[model samples]
Target: MNATGAWDRLEPKLAATNARVAALESDPSRRNSFVAYTMERDSAYCDLDGERLLMMSGYSYLGLAGDERVVAAAKAAVDVYGTGNHGVRALAGTIPLHEELEAEVARFAGRERALVFGSGYAANVGTVGALVGQGDTVLIDKYDHASIVDGCRLSGATVTRFRHNDVDHLERRLKAAAPTGVRLVIVDSVYSMDGDIAPLPELREVCDRYDALLMVDEAHALGVIGKTGGGIEEHFDHKVRVDVKLGTLSKAIPSMGGWIAGSHDLIGHLRYAARPFLFSAALGPAQTGAALESLRILRREPERVTHTQTQAQRLRTRLNDAGISTMDSTTAVLPVIAGSDDAAYDYATACRKAGVIGLPVVTPAVPNDLARLRIAVTARHTAADIDFAAEAFLTAAAQTGLI
Candidate 1:
């Protein structure tokens, strides 16, 4: 039964996705998703499929993806420490670079200490499972990252999801929960799809009232917000307390791995207790070195954060002014609503044909009627580039009959 009946039972569940993929792949102009980059010209542009399209879908928000300094650090680390570590970090995997990277992350995030994980997904799942169990309660945003949702499911904690960005709904749920075990409220600092920010101050006030610990994932917020790219704290210029702060290194840091920053005691507990950290091999030296260097650059040149946000608004405005709905985005990410799954595919196909590479987010990632093209504008995209991308998007919308 295990061998013969597995796919037979599972294939039906995938029929819709299969059809969507078939339609998506049928387009001759579609080439963005899952394509390997042969070369990167800079932070703003990459060479793919024998063409150099303007990139509107990358996560290097601070323009440091191919910075000479970052590349140099990664190369130097490989020369000294070689390619990989010996074992799991608990045993022989830890390196000087790992310790140095953690310290720098803690410093940059204004936390007492930091613990690094093999990946951001690991950080969330492992930390959540380590922190809570039966009888504990966890509340999360409806639109948080999938990793966060998986973390809650695996934690053995009773999970409650509140409406997206509604603090009042959260308060009501908190009031109704049993007042015995730990209550943790988690959210993303900057929502990945909608690109709106979490109301940190409001969340802190509500969490404090309920004695609930607050956690915020900075995956999309770290390099896109803040005055000096200081993340949620800087974005609001408010001294809100976030008990558990976790984020990924792959996005703005332009490297691999992840880190959880918090009080020294929390870091100490997670270092020894988190299963993902305990079981997985340590982060590679090159990734650690690259992240460290990128962070240093972010510290020295915060204006890049401002530039990225400005260009994002510039693009958002252009699209909105053209009567296209961007749907509540106010950060470097702009969600260009495309109506439905088929419409999203058509929009992306038309978009690629016009020499821009913005990808689509269709159901069930988003509601069917709200399917969209998620365009993330990074730093180093000049005003001209932003204008060009905007016009290209408008043209695609027209071609797809979405306007």
Candidate 2:
């Protein structure tokens, strides 16, 4: 077909999608619903549309994003390494900083070796695709992150999803898979939306019984769980036999990139086989330096982890006392159910008007009935800040008729 004819055929579908988006964005009640707000400062509290709002939906759990030491490290690295690394790691992009960061990550994760990726999504996608393929069976939680779902699809593996956090459902699926091929079970250590933790010890037993390899994504758990922010294994107070550990530096680390930590042989194989690791440009020197400093800070100051968890508990208690529903949240993430998409958006808008920034998570990201304001608590939030946020939430709920 001619170029003009092809354009004519494809234009309608694209226009229809754009029209739907415009309808949602232009609605008076839902305006500014899912739009990103420009942050004038760090995430603790940010200026949005000329109004300063206390950040309640950010993921920098330990408040390391604006830490002077971390920023200084990043600045020093920029001074020495310039801006970009210029090539993929396998070629000329590999630097001493990369090796140093990898070693520190492996040590932090309690693994023999670690491999870094350009981003957490790349880490999951590349690791899963590199480890398993056609004829292999990959089992994942129904509520796993999108990157994990994409990884499973890309691997060409026989993918099956068990019910969310239901070990019995997982066991049933494991029993049905073929006995000859590689059997892998993957789950998030802490579900991002629900804020509930995975039953890691129970899952370890199930994997052992089925002779399956277990992988846990610690994207939200690291620097927020465990005694010293060591992640799921540390949180459980027992070293669960997790075969593969995957996490992102963007959250608690307050930097870019992701990592997969495991046996030396496994990491070595991924270094050559993982497409994302091999083809993607390396993580910037500034990010690596910042992450390294953050990790060190986390180790030296374990109080940050404890303080974050304590504050999360306080927020949940305040919400519950005010008769607001915080569904299944036990970690720094708190979801206040708002019933419907419009209600969730309305609640978030109300919170914003009350001097807090809590984002609404609507349908497609969550179930229709589970739409909520995803509030995130961090170490940076003081007791007074928590109290103020709780008061604002209660007032917003009352104003929106959500209480």
Candidate 3:
């Protein structure tokens, strides 16, 4: 059948969803504030048609997205190692650069060993699947990343969810599962959407009491928290030996890839057993080189990490002062709750219309009543730029009757 015909068959179901979105758009509290367009971007702002607005929609929390140093390193690696690894990592793709990047990530994360993967999703899937199996139990935060949930599913393990950041609920669930199977608790160090932090130390203590191995995904935490950018484990000053520390290089590292930092034995096992590692191409030379360079910069310039947190706090405080809902965040991610999916999308569009590109997160990314404008602050934002963003958001919210 033709693509049109295939789509026609599914249109009814999709139209129902569209109707709900449209209804939300018509809401008096959101109608006046919506954007619809393509945007051209610069270093810290994007041009929405003819208007220039501060850019606040990126995961480039360190403003290293297009840094000259990282770019030059990538180009040099391309010249030296070409564009692709050309084979799976176990084959002819394993290069010296990959080894170097892995070592740097492992050291930076304060772990004895690390294994690089194709992406953060790949790391979670491969590692979690490898570590657990059928009959084992995996306890995850309700707001955990989708990748972690999929990982649990692929592992053939029974999955259970506790309330978001609720240590009591986590403990209750963990204790309930203790007598049944091998237990694993996985949580994001800093939740990607809600902008709230996980109570990692409390969770760790609960896990210890139940003999469950604790896993922490710092895809949004690394490079933005901890004294050395080690993430929530470092942020809370809790030194619980995280059995698995998963992170992504695409964010703060300003590169593309992921890593699992853990004990040497565990990493070595993933090297041999993880299907993603065995089947996926090795990290490209340019990506590996750029990530390595970024890691070096992170270690050498700890100020960059501190600056990101300070910027986040500054922006969060400003938004709060302006009567904008920041959703209890204390990290680089600041969420402006819009209450409904349509409202969230409209608010994001309105921000774009005002010249800022802000990301609107809605279900199934977040629960249905918690749709929000997920803004990731970076050290690259100046005080003036922050003020501009805050004012624009407040204006947009007021115009839409959101505030």
Candidate 4:
């Protein structure tokens, strides 16, 4: 098509999107949807239109984002390495901090080696594409992160999904695709939206029976689920034979990269074959240094994990006592289902008005009926903070008729 023809086709779609966004913004209840908020301090709180609100929707599970030691490490890295690495990792971008960070991550994950990527999305896309091809297959949990779904699609492989955490459904799919070439199963150790854990042991068993590789994304689980902040394997009190362990540094580690940890051979292969790792700029020195220090902190202060989980449990109990549905959550993340998109938005706005900042997760991020207020608890949150947040949430639910 010529330029004019292309514009003709694109203009209508762009207009339609604009109209949709305008409609959403015009509603008073939806006015706060996707509004940009400035963090006056750290991830625990932010300023929205001059109002400070306690944050309850962030992914900084360990509360290390603004820790003094982590900040000092990052500043020191900036002083030594300057601001950025000028080349892709494969050529000249690799630095001492990068290697050190990868080593620390691998050790923490109990893997032989680990390779870092510019972003968690890049890591997933690069890993999946490098592992499977046209003739290969990938089976993922229906509720896995969008990055995982995109990675599977980018791999040029046959992609199938099983019901969320339903091992029987997964086994049926595996049985149907038995004896396949390069069959891989992917799941999140903790589901992000629902804050529930995967059935890792059962999934591992089925994968072993089918001779398939099992990959677990530990993005939300690493510092929130396990006894020593070691993720799902530690949560279960046993290693579950995960073939690939994937995670992001920005969440619990409070940095800006992702990693894939596994056997030496697997990391070695990805180092050579993963396009995103090879072509993208390396993770910056500040993030690497900060992540390294944050990992150390997690190791030294295991009680942070306990504190976060305990606070989350207390919040869940409070909400449930108020007749609010927390929807299978057993971790730091909690979802208060609102049954409709409008209701979810209204509840979030009411919570913000009541001094908390829980965000709404609506269709098609979730099913239409399962729209919710997604709340995340951090180690920095005290019992009083939990109580305040719970009260705010209950008040909002009542005001919005969500309970």
Candidate 3 similarity to native, TM-score: 0.91
Q: lDDT: which is higher, 2 or 4?
A: 2
lDDT of each: 0.89, 0.90, 0.84, 0.89
**Model 2: residues >4 Å from true position, as ranges?**
27-43
| Overall local distance difference test of candidate 2 | 0.90
Give the per-residue lDDT of model 4 (tens digit) for 1-403.
Answer: 5699889979999999788667645665467566787754344678877778888998889888888899999999999998999798888898999999899999999999999899888899899999998888899999999999999998899999999899999999988873658999999999999999998889999999888999999999999998988999899987666999999998988888899999999999999888888888999889889999999899899999998999999999999988988888999989999887777777888998899989888878898789888999998788998999999998988888776
Give the alpha carbon lDDT tens digit for every residue of 31-84 in model 3: 323454332322676555466667786787777777788889999999999999
Off by over 4 Å in 4: 27-29, 40-43
Clashes of each: 0, 0, 2, 0
TM-score of each prediction: 0.96, 0.96, 0.91, 0.96
lDDT of 1 by residue, 1-403 (tens): 5666887878887896777677766755664457776537464666766888888888888888888899999999999999999999999999999999999999988999999999999999999988988999999999988888998999899999999999999999999988899999999999998999999999999999999999999999988888888889888885776899998999888898889999999999998889999999999989989999999898899899999988988998899899998888888989988887777878888888888888988877886688889999888699999998999999988888878
When superposed on Cα atoms, how far off is each prediction in RMSD? 1.7, 1.9, 3.4, 1.8
Error of 1 at 169 (Å): 0.4
What tens digits encode model 2's per-residue C-alpha lDDT throughout 190-226? 8899899999999999999999999999999998888
Top-lDDT candidate index? 2
Q: List the residue pairs that clash in candidate 3.
A: 35-349, 53-355
Cα distance off (Å), candidate 4, residue 96: 0.2
